[model samples]
Target: MNEYQPQEQLQNATLILILGILSIIGCFCYGVLGIILAIVALILAQKATKTYAQNPEMYLGYQNVKIGKILAIIGLVISVIYMCLVIWLIVTFGMEALQDQELMQQRLEEMMGQ
Candidate 1:
């Protein structure tokens, strides 16, 4: 017969929690890393849940897994939104810069009597 292991369950939960936190941090600094970490966190959280199910006494582990999953999802969503916003800002500013350059050139030529 197999015995339940609280330490192993807790360890898995901790791993998931760490991945989730890393994912959130990555979201602010790097989108690709954030998405990858979030995905790994999600998978680890699921594994932790299964471990908790096998050992019903590990309530702390179960709670950690749940929190990890939530954090992972939040990180992934924020990363995507952040990337989109960055792209939008870049495009908007690029167009504005081009227009400004054209205006400046026209003014310079006018001043030069050309």
Candidate 2:
């Protein structure tokens, strides 16, 4: 049976964290993928915490786990905010399009009458 190792767990957590950060940076080019990475990082961080709790004596990577968690959370929040802004912009544009159509119709009617 493989024994639990703190260093290994910490390393995994750090990798996840890095991936999450990179994902956030990539958000400009790949929005949905970035959000997925953030969520994966968050899950890995939580796993690291649980491992630490199970083996307090081998708590070598607690700091790494904490850092990973923070990065994941920040990335996730940023992604959510970006998505919300995009949705709002789309809705606003649609409304503007409808208004433009109405104005164009009114103008056409006036031109015909005159």
Task: List TM-score per model, in order.
Answer: 0.64, 0.65
- Report the number of the highest-lDDT candidate: 1
Best by TM-score: 2
Steric clash pairs (candidate 1): none
- How does model 2 score by TM-score? 0.65
The stretch of ten residues in a row with the least summed lDDT in candidate 1 is: 89-98
* Clashes, model 1: 0
- Cα error of candidate 2 at position 18, Å: 0.7
Tens-digit lDDT track for model 2 on 1-114? 978654443548568758767667756542566688878888887777787788667657677667767777777777778877767655644545435877656655775898
Can you give the lDDT of residue 89 in candidate 2? 50
In angstroms, how far off is 113's CA in candidate 2?
25
